[model samples]
Target: MSWDLSFMFDDLLPALLVGLQYTVLSTVLGYLIALLLGLLIAVVRRVRVVGPVAHGIMEFIRTTPLLIQLVFVFTLVPPTVTPLTVGVVVLGVHYAAYTAEVYRSGIEGVAKGQWEAARALSLPLRRTWGAIVLPQAIRKVIPALGNYLIAMFKDTPLLFAIGVTEMLMMAQRVGQPAGRVMEAYTLVGIMFLLVSIPSAILIRRLERRYAAV
Candidate 1:
């Protein structure tokens, strides 16, 4: 079929932009969950006894396909939970496993002498972690976290599988009605690139800035 630039610009693009709102909302909310839960998971894994279980669960979460997790969470949750909520939550949790590792690596990057010095100064555990550890760790890993945000935004299209009408799904709906899905799908990809590329460049700049530090 012929490429329908007019239909793409007038119809598919508009529909995709509407869905873009859900896509952005899911990514932002999901990333917030990941940021908090991932830090908690990282801290929890420092305990020698509980660490193994957290490690095992993180391993399981990291290894599993996210689509499966989304489906499982949807099935397990109460009926009142909206699909958008499910997507936000599942996306957060799925990425949390990864972010946990990122946090761990950031923590490990702290100098051993810093830990020794904190002990020598008799710093309270909370103070040591809050003042000496997490700030440095989180700062070092901010770029990594930003990359994951971009990845999550890209993955928001997967929400379609779980009935969240994100950009790609909206495009599909716009196009399938007339059996001309090419323009719709094409615009979806273009929009993703438009967003993801600049974000990636900004992250790269941050990575360079951090590396210099």
Candidate 2:
């Protein structure tokens, strides 16, 4: 069948746009959780007694499939929680495993002299990290985090596995019953391209700008 430009722009676009809102919301909320939780995991992994355990958990989470994680959370959490909520939290925790490493690498990138300088100044441990370490580390890692946000944006389609009805699912809903697939699916792909491509370029520019620092 020939492409239906009118249907794509009219029917499919609205459904996909609604779905796109969910996609962006999940990506953003999920990434916010990832940033906070990942930082905590990174910090906790430095603890002498619990470090290895934390590292093991991080590895386990990293190695597992994200879809399985989402499904598992859906089953494990109380029924009162919506699938979208489960999807968001699972996405956050799943990526937190990866983001922790991002944070760890960022932390390692901080100069040893800086650590020594903090010691030399006799700053409290918390203050040393708060005032000196994290600010520098976070600056270096902002681009990396932006990349993950894009990754999360792409991954939002997976939320449909748990019935969350993100973009891909919306495309299928728009297309399947109508007995045509190309227009709706193509629009969804274009929607992703429109957002992701420019975002990727911006992140690359940011990475270069950060590197020049």
TM-score of each: 0.97, 0.97
**Model 2, range 1-213, lDDT digits (tens) per residue?**
688788888888999999999999999999999999999999998899988999999999999999889988888988899998999999999999989999999999999999999999999999999999999999999899989999999999899999998899999998999876888878888999999999999999999999854
Give the CA lDDT, 0 to 100, for residue 36 in model 2: 98
Candidate 1 segments whose C-alpha is farther than 4 A from its true place: none
- Candidate 2 C-alpha error for residue 36, in Å: 0.7
Give every collision pair in model 1. none
Off by over 4 Å in 2: none
lDDT for model 1, please. 0.92
lDDT of 1 by residue, 175-198 (tens): 999777888888888899999999
Clashes of each: 0, 0
